[model samples]
Target chain A: MRRITILGLTVLVTAAVLVAAPLLGLETIDPRQVAGGAGAGPEARIFWSLRVPRVMLGFLAGAALSVGGLTFQALFRNALATPYTLGVSSGAALGATLAIRLGAAFSLLGIPAVSLAAFAGALLAVALVYGLARARQGCSANIMLLAGVAVNFSFASLILLVHYTSDAAASFNILRWLMGRLDTVGPDEALRLLPLVAVGGFVALALHRELNLMSVDEELAVSRGVDVDRYRVILFVTTSVMVGGVVAACGPIGFVGMMVPHVCRLLIGPDHRWLGPMSLLAGGAFLVACDVLARLLAAPAELPVGVLTSLLGGPFFLWLLVGRRGAACSA
Target chain B: MDANRTLTPVLDLRHLRLELDGRSILDDVSLAVREGEHLAIVGPNGAGKTCLLKCVNRILRGWRGMISVNGVSIAAFSQRELGRLVAYVPQVGGRLTPFTARETVLMARYPHLTPFAAPGLRDQRYAEDALALTGIGALADRSLDTLSGGERQKVYLAAALAQDARLLLLDEPATFLDPRHRDDFRRVLRTVNRRKGVTVVEVTHDLNCAVLDADRIFALKDGRAAFCGPPEQFMVREVMHRVFDRAFLTVNHPTTGQPVILPEVGGP
Candidate 1:
């Protein structure tokens, strides 16, 4: 009951923050003034075109990645598992890099070329992992993780090769994107990606019970009338869309997917019905708060939100590992 | 007793063959378990006992031949349908998270639940009743991770009971428990079979325990049924020697009049 209450309060707090962010008198210029045709001032354009979209994108990306992380972790039944652990992010990065190298225009369909490439790359990576793992009888969690690591390493090398060959300007842009900055996102881009994220998130939510059973024991899950292979395919594909979509919009934001779910699991019990959705909401709030801190701490020039999340998540993860080990050792 | 009245078999396996890695594991194994009957499968290690159990639950899908439950081919049934009919409990071990005992049992109802729908009050009531029946209602709120080996085994049994399956397949349910707990586990199984009429097929290495409760005993040798009959048949020295490949002295229990086999000194 306490945990439920905490989750409820957290949801309310996050909703309030998301709603009141724009309305707060943080800056002198009123967004209403700029909208009322008051000379089309720079501040109003920045508010509408820049900060609002960036905030929205941060929330969307954070929620998507975190939920993807929860799904992957449960599906694999590995504590160290994440969506990118399978090389999806690296694959997406490589695809985006190749697209940029081919001179594809970002404004072609109101969707960035890089994001499109990333999505395609992520799907391909998932296919590759599934294909390799399925070849040996059935796709067990251990085999999938091993396959993912192999694919990730291979793709990382390709990404590095691309990075070396690219020109200075392209390299700089790629480097910044890889660090995961939400500064360049516009409101239109967030609107474009929201539907895909929401749909994928909902599909994931629906499979929570099956995923929980899968986490316990795959063979047991099969006996329980769950089509284990089919559910695995659905879960992997859905996570691909969520993670691939986010990686495309913003470069691989490390640890959001990894840390958020683990933290949520510790706070709430291992019930996926609550764990999966709460991870998304908490992850979104966490990123927004981190983004706000990144902006305020380095006003005029912002720190990459990914950097802050990693800085926070890395230490917390190590602490959890030590604590878990201590508990196991003592027990 | 009406000896002419044939009891309907709840589980039947005919001409069953299992091949793994180009090696035959189970070959032409045939068995029939009557409704509400308690059957025990005994075999030496690596005798394909586990493989046979897996085949019954469709965990090993590549097996050949006929396996039917309630007169329907198991292959024709969907996974959900199979789950509703059969509940499988495997040997328990490995990393387990801390789920409350009630929550753990509630997972058994997953097959009955639709995607995105929560369990109704009826489901909860059933779960509660199952917990009470298993005699673990007091431990319902405790974390599974904190339970002792014996307690954990009971919890799993409760979960299987909550599934409300017609046939229960257990692989070595008594392997990790002490003698007392093992007896308790068998008592629960006997009660469930008697009251709920749930057919039980369990794989066990304990020959003594198998004799104590099994209505029918099937002794497997190299993946084939070497002996299938009453416990008294297993005590015959010649039968034991042929299947177990050892010399044994058969003696009658002074009080119970049951044949008991004791390993004889000197030769096979």
Candidate 2:
């Protein structure tokens, strides 16, 4: 009952923020004027095109990343594990850099050329890790983790090499993209990402029980009727696609994945049934809150929401590590 | 040929061999267990007792042997089917998540639950019953990490009992218990065996506990079956000494007439 109450409160707060966030920009949006279409001018265009899309993008990206992060953490049984730990972010960055350097002009369907490249790159990286881990003694979590770390480092160095040789325009783009931002074209783009979040979120929540067992012990899970290998493969593919979409959409928003799940777990405990959906909801609200502060704090010049999240998350993460160490020592 | 057909053994393993990273863990081991029988596998450290149990639970794959449960090859059974037949209580616990004792025990219903379905009322009753059976009903709402060693041990046992499997595999279950808790555990095991007719296979280093509880004792030495018979045959000083590489003085318990081996030492 308490968990349900907490979830209800979180959802209420999230909905309130979702509605009020777009109105609190540099030019406050008057809902009455916009609703009746009487004063639907440049202010309306900015409200509909810029603020609404940006906030929705933030919410969807946050939700996808949080689900991805929670799944990865449970899959690896490591609290610090995140959605990008498997090199997807590095891969997306590399792809975006390559697109920038190549001066790609074609956009597939409605996705920007650079975002499409990024999505492709993230999938490629996951496929490589999966293949490498699967080829030798099955796709175990340890093998996947090690393979991902290796791939991440390799891609990181390659990205540096690209930055080293690229022109000033391309270099700036690469750096800006790597820093993470929620730059959306319009409401249509944000709406396009909703399906990915919805499907991925559903699949993740549905498998919460399996995640609960797997997090405890893989061998024990297997002994208790869980097909560990099959579940691991499904989780890998689901989280990869989810994280890939988020990275492509928002240029690898940092810390939303790691920080949100940790906070949710602390709030409701480690039962993934609650942890999964709560993290998704809380994560979306958190990013919206962060984006609001980002807009309000710097005023005309906007700080990247990702930067603020990292600044906040980094210290909390350190505090958590120190707190856990202290507890372990005392125990 | 006998007029009556022989009863099929509940468990049968033939010429089982397991090699891990170029090292032999179990070598040509074989055994058969009848229905409702309680068996104990005892040995020194590194004697492959746990390895044998792992093979039965199908945790360690790539073993060259035929393992049949009730005349059906274990290889043919899906992991879930195998789970319905066997419940394994590992020696060392995993990292404690924030699950209460009730929640932890309720996980034993995973095999019976449909995918994406929650545990039903029947499952909750089973979990509660298992907790009561293990005498940890009062601790059901407590977080598992907050429980003491003995309490945690009972929680694990309750979880396994809630599995409702026919075969129970325990690895050094009493390692963390005091004498009183150990007695309680033994009583619980006996009740489960007698009332539920569950076959039990325990790996332990305590021969006295084995002799007192098990109908048959299987002793392993260097990954081979050194002795497999009733406790009377296994009570021989030479058999005990050879398996453990130590001298033993045997005595019969006055009340139960069970054999007890005391290690021979020059002093103290």
Candidate 3:
């Protein structure tokens, strides 16, 4: 009951912030001018075309990736597991790099081309990990973790290889994309990506009870009528779709996926019914706050949201590890 | 008891074979536990006793065998159906967080509860009844992690009892308890078997406890049933020595007239 109330308040506060953000006079341009029939001057165009879309994308991507992380964490029973842990981010990066290399001819389909490629890449990465892990007897957690690490490193090296070989201007563009910037997206992109994120998140939330049983113990889960392989496959595909959608819109933003779920679990306990949705909301709120800070910290020249998340999350992660260490030793 | 009524076998294992890493853990084991029967599996460590228990409860799968409950093969039944028929209590260890004793018992009804629905009146009534039966009613609201070993064991037993299963498979249910608590647990088991007609299959190393309440005893040795019959068969020194690989002098108690095995000094 307390968890429900806390989550309810969180949702209300988030909705309020999303509603009140434009009214706060924090943005460089006026949202009213963009919405009204008044001509879209440079400020109105910037507000409508860039800032609004970017903030909305930030919210969607944050929620999608963090929810994906929560699913993976529950599926694998590992706190370190995330959307990026299985090489999906690197796969999406590779796809974007490939699209950029294709040049002006690919611009006809605009952002959809990159998103499609990213979806395919993320699916491919998951397939690879699944195949590797399934080859072992009974699908051990250690084997899955090893496969994830191997696939991530291989894809990351390929992405670096693509970066090094590309032309100077293309290299710069790819570098900026890799550094995780949301400035380039327009409203069209956010609308296009929202459905995939929403569908994936819904499917994940729908599997709450199954995920909760899985979280207890995998063997126990199987004994309780869960087809462990089938559930893992569904979770992998859904999380990949969500992560791919987010990575296609903005570059791979880490930390939100890895940290948000753990924090949500601590607050609401391990019941996935609460943990899953709470992580989604918390992720959005956290990223919005981070994005706001990113803009305000450097003013005109903004820092990458990824940099801020890492700077904050790295220490928090160490503290968590230390705490877990103390807990284990004491026990 | 009506002789005209057909009694359902709570657990039926036929030619069950379990192999792990090329070694047979349970080989061609077959047994039938009838309704209201209290069968105790007594064996040395690593004698496939726990493996047999796990197989019957469907915890460790991949065994080549026929395991049935109430004439339905385990493979044919859904896990929910199987769980409804059988409840397994593992050896107690570690703390399950956030779940109070009532909540833990409530988890036994997971198979019965509809998805996303809270426990109804029936479930609550059953939960209370189970707690009362296991003598953990006072600990219902207490966190399972905060309880003592014996108390936690009772909570776990209560959770299993709340499943309303006819077959209760317990692995070392009294290992963590003192002699008095152990006796209390045995008394509860006897009462539950007699009153509720719940079939109890327990694995224990304690010979005296098994001999006291068990209607039958099965002694396992090196992944095979060395001896299985009435309690009198297991009371023999030769049979005990063959199963346990230890020399023992059998003595008859003056008051109870039960045979007690004492370790033989300088005699094999």
Candidate 4:
């Protein structure tokens, strides 16, 4: 009953935000004009084409990041773990840098060349991490985590190398992309991301029970009949696809995945059934609201949503770490 | 002997050898447990008692020899199939977990539930029944992190019981229990073994508890069974002294006539 109430409240908030988000952007959107009557003017175009897609993109990217973050955290059994923590973002950055360096101008199947390149890069990083971890007997969480850290550092240097070789304009583009941005996505990009996030979210919800068991104890999970190794691989692959999609769409928005799941867990107990969907809804709402604040706070200037989120999430993460010493030690 | 004596043994392990990092963790050990029999294994800290239990459950796989469950080779059974046939209770030392006692117990139904299906009413009922059997039904809603050590141990036992498996492999089940809870655990074990006809293989450090509970006793020394027989046979002072490397005094229970042993304080 309490879980239902929490879920209901979260859905209500998400719905409210979804309706109100388009109204808060720089241009005033007349709802009557958007409702489609005579004299609709420029409001209809701005509402439909610009604000709606941007907000949709924000929600989609946030949901994907949070869901992927939750999955990775549960798999690794570490709260500090996130989709971006293991070089996915850096990989995407590298891919985007390559695209900029090559002067790529063509879009592939509706997705921009840069996003396509970023997605490919994210998948490559996941493959590299998975391969390195699997090469050692079992893909133990510790080994995978260490491998991810190593990949992250190597990818960072590779990004720097790409910057060194590329011209000044390409280097600036790469650095801006690395800071993470959530605006400027089109309806086509949002459409491309929707199906992937939907499938990934569905799979995650379906396996939430297994995640619950695995999080507590991996050996115990196996003894209770979870195909631990098989499930781990499935989860890793699923999270990679989801993270890749999000990064490709929004230049690797930071902290949504790491922050949202932990917040949702605190709200509803760690039952992933509740945590999974709740985190997604809360995450989408969170990013949209943050984007709104970023717009309002700077007015014409507009702070990057990623920058605002990181500013908030970094401290919350520290508080979480410091407040729960026991979890910190064990996790 | 009963009519079921003609049936296959519930558990059969033959020449099982496990080498970890080139060290012989288990060396050519063989044993069999009959249907519904309660067997207790007692040994020192490094006597491979836990390792042997792990072998039976296939948790630590890649053993050199064969393990059969009810006349079927373990290799033939999938992990889920084996899980339905056997439940394991590991020795957890009051670790804080994010699951409620009921939720933890319901996890036993994982092997029974189809992948992507939530636990149905039937599973919840069975979990509740197990909690009742362990006398922890009232505490089922409590988080495992908040439960007392004894209560937590009972929750683990309840979870194992909820599996409803034919065989149970317990490692130091009473390690965290107080005297009353220990008795409660023994009673629960008796109910499961006798009433439900479940086979049990328990690793315990408490010799007295074993004598009071188990139908048969298996003593291990350095990964090898030093003694395997009825509790009466295990009560022999010379065999007890030899297995534990200490002198022991034997006493029969006043009411049940079961043999109990106590190690002498000054024994070499």
Ranking by TM-score: 2, 1, 4, 3
lDDT of 2 at A50: 85
Q: Any runs in candidate 2 off by more than 4 Å, and if so which?
A: A36-39, A135-140, A324-331, B1-6, B253-257, B266-268
Model 1 is docked with a DockQ of: 0.58
**TM-score of model 3 relative to the true fold?**
0.88
Q: What's the C-alpha lDDT at position A137 in model 2?
A: 71
**Tens digits of per-residue lDDT for model 4, B1-268:** 5876637899998998888767888888899999999999998888889999888777787788889999899889888888899998889584578778999999888889987888999999999999999999899888888888889989989988888899999999897688999899999999999999999999998988887788999988998889999888888889888888889997777898766677777866
Candidate 4 chain B worst ten-residue window by lDDT? B258-267
The clash count of every prediction, one per candidate, is 0, 0, 0, 0
How much DockQ does model 2 earn? 0.55
Report how far off residue A286 is in candidate 1 (Å): 1.1
The CAPRI classification for model 1 reads as medium
DockQ of each: 0.58, 0.55, 0.34, 0.56
Q: Give all candidates' CA lDDT scores.
A: 0.81, 0.85, 0.78, 0.85
Clashing pairs in 1: none
Scanning candidate 1 chain A in windows of ten residues, the lowest lDDT window is: A322-331
Indicate whether candidate 3 or candidate 4 has the larger DockQ: 4
| lDDT for each residue of candidate 1 in B1-268, tens digit (9 for 90 to 100) | 2443235568999999999988989989999988878899987778889999999888888999899998889999988889999998888573464677898788888878876687778778878987887788999999777888888888888888888899999999889899888888888899998887888999987777787788888988898988999877776778777777878886778999776667788978
TM-score between candidate 4 and the true structure: 0.93
RMSD list, candidates in order: 2.9, 3.0, 3.4, 2.7
- Docking tier of model 3: it is acceptable
- Per-residue CA lDDT of model 2 for A160-247, tens digit only, reads 9999999999899888888788867578778878888887888889998899988888878877878777788888787888889888
